[model samples]
Target: MIALDIAIKNKYYANSTAVVLKDIQFSVKPGEFVAIIGPSGSGKTTLLNMLSGLEDATAQKLLGNSKSLHDCKEYQLGYVFQQPRLMPWLTVNENIQLVLPTAQERKIKTLLAQVGLADKGDYYPKQLSGGMQRRVAIARAFAVNPELILLDEPFNSLDAPTAAKLRLLLVNLCKSCGSTVVFVTHDLSEAIYLADRIIFMSNSPSSIIHQVNVNLPKPRKESGSTELAWQSQLMAQYPQILSGSVSTD
Candidate 1:
């Protein structure tokens, strides 16, 4: 459903130029969920922005449904940022409804309920916890019934337990809707649990160093037998972490 041939070069710092991304080539099949994990400043967000068509592709081209990014008619993109980015003045239901572009009240209620916010639709952003607000953000994204969703650290603010639960909920929701998801995170365990394939990038001026298929079954567990093996693999792939003691699960 999505294809990218990206080559990004920028001088964010001094006179030295940095090749943030280099001829990065990848494709996402319809209804597939792919996770991108990398060290900080590894251009993961940059890649996501390009894929979402929010940022101008520097030296790359994206084709979806065999059509260029500009020509693809089926392209409906939704984004979930690290922050919930909810409007404080709006109720949770209203927040989600803002994106629906529909007068269907039933649609808003159904979406709020889908994200486990049925009872909280009347509440405002300030009245809810961080996780709840994020849920509202998610409902807003999925409420649009997007063909492609770009999630950039969607669970960054939540506690471990909350984050883990939301991760699974998101996976199931996407699967049921047949939405293609490109999730970006620095969390290895989150990636392993939620992704069909995990792409790892090295440090700054980074490129895809490893792409491992998560052979585990769907609805992954936090304490699974293969968890340790995946952790070991990521640790080995990580450059600065020489200890190889990083645990993912």
Candidate 2:
């Protein structure tokens, strides 16, 4: 059975005549790492928002685990957005506690330690650096042992070294949690390094245009040759895949 099955018929703003997404359909197997890449306006974030219940367009619908998201109440989902969105007033530990039905001290501590923020739990959001705050965000998401994790450009703005480190940590966390992942990013190399399968979307009124299975060996590094090779090969072979208007086939 699939962990997620997205089939959005159409999506557009309430007052707008333009369509943002259409005929977008795909299914992700349990524990699979899938990344979605597309141009700037391809509705990638919109899709995530809908799935997370952040937005509900009258004309747009999404199915998760073969059932509507509204009805999938028994399952757990975690989301890490483009920003950490931490509560400045709350300490890191408290922020993580917000998601749990009951405060879990041991689980919270383990998550922080896993993200290299064990010592910062008592610190407020403002006390930590940008990267540290993001780490806390990740820890918070994993605290509940989510069945699915949705990440929207979570590592986009960090320095290269930090982003690379977090990427590895995220992979490890996914494995330990056995959670299905759906990551959205514009970085081609990032997708290559992290995803088992990469799904490409078209521009506005986006749809799944192409998909690449990344069968590279694991323990992947950001600067690893296998990832670079795939990047170079894909760029040369399908120059317009990122444009979302052309077919690599």
Candidate 3:
């Protein structure tokens, strides 16, 4: 289990009076996929940073089981950014090797195959298309075999078709790894499709405004009628969420 109750203070300010995230609270069960969505500048990335131990929080109390965030030495983390962020100098296989330096060559090849890039492993980052580079990044993230994965709108920049394909790949990878995921996305439909629970946030000085349990069955299809119906019902019930007005203190 992962639990967080923290507030992030602006590091640039001397007084530290500015708080970007205001006492945000939530928990993620093991093997659960949670999506965080909010308006622009709502501190979604800041929250992810805090969770990943990249930033410090004031009066924070984050616990992963019996270990606190500061001392959770056993936890393994993986991150996929909006951009692919691959090393241009490395081949597709070598980029993955950068993470799992000792992983077997056969295992690396299998990962490439899983991401639909089996034949492209020998290609350099510049040789691949934008979407393909992102696929390589995804493959590298999973290669770490992290216990928790953080995604910051990895598909936001892709066209609809490409993004949909990556989403499917992500779902399959998560299921196979049983890794707990905290995905931050601006797209409501994507969140609805991927998250086991959606944690909605307020604007800057953000806090948890509400949490919506998806309650959908496993192996969700993006275009299936069930997904469409759920999306319609969710939007109908909380139209403000789609419009970035769900914040209520």
Candidate 4:
């Protein structure tokens, strides 16, 4: 299980202070998929950084499997950022190998195939399309068999078709790996399709305003009536979710 109770403060300028996040609290069950949805500047990425122990915060307490995040040295974590962040000089295969040097060549090749890039292993980041690069990042994230995976709008840049394909790929990988996933996205429909639970935050100086259980069966179909219905319900119930305005004070 993963649990967090944290607050974050930022000094965006010399004279002013901004509380990017306040009184944030949530938990994720083992092998569960959770999605965080909020406005553009609501500090969602900052929350991810705190979970990954990459940022310092004033009142941060993160727990994983009953151990403090700082003390849980045995848990393996993986991250897929908005951008692929691949090494331009290395081939696709080399980029994944860089992280998992002990992994066999055949296993690496198998991963490439899983992401529909089996034939592109020898290509560099520049040679592949944007979506393909993102796939490489996804494959790399799973190559290490991490216990917790964090994703921050990894498909935001892709077109609808590409994004849908990647989402399916992600779900398959998550099912196979059984890793706890915390995904942050602005797309509510996407959230409904992929997450077991959706956490909605208010505007900057954000706090969790609502949490919705998807309760949708797995292997969700893309763009079906069921998904559309849930999306409509969410939008009607929480219209401020996508474009939020909340008083920080």
Candidate 4 structure quality by residue, lDDT tens digits, 1-249: 344333343413224575777778788888889999998988899888778877664345677876777676777888999899999999999999998848579988999999999999999999999999999999999998888999999999799999999999999999888898999999888898999999888887888888889987877887779888888886776555676632332
Q: For residue 54, give model 1's deviation from the true position in Å.
A: 1.9
Instruction: Pick the winner on TM-score between candidates 2 and 3.
Output: 2
Count of steric clashes across candidates, in order: 0, 0, 0, 0
Query: In candidate 3, which residue pairs clash?
Result: none
lDDT of each: 0.75, 0.87, 0.82, 0.84
In angstroms, give how far residue 144 of model 2 lies from its true place: 1.2
Q: How do the residues 1-249 of candidate 2 rate in per-residue lDDT, one tens digit apiece?
A: 237777788787657879888898888888899999999978899988888888774555566666787676888889999999998999999999998999689989989999998888899999999999899999988887888889999998899999989999998998789888899999988988889999999888888888889999886878688789888888888889888856556
Best by TM-score: 2
- Rank order by lDDT, top first? 2, 4, 3, 1
Worst 10 residues of 2 by lDDT: 57-66
How well does each candidate superpose onto the true structure, as a TM-score? Answer: 0.86, 0.95, 0.90, 0.91
For model 1, the stretches where C-alpha displacement exceeds 4 angstroms are: 1-18, 233-249
lDDT by residue for model 1 (30-137), tens: 777889888877778878877777666634667666567655656677899889999999998788778776776888888778788889988999999999899889
Sort by TM-score, best first: 2, 4, 3, 1
Instruction: Evaluate residue 134 in candidate 1 and report its C-alpha lDDT on the 0 to 100 scale.
Output: 90
Per-residue CA lDDT of model 3 for 211-248, tens digit only, reads 88999898888867888999888777777874356633
Cα displacement (angstroms), candidate 2, residue 177, comes to 0.6
Q: What's the residue-level lDDT of 234 in candidate 2? A: 86
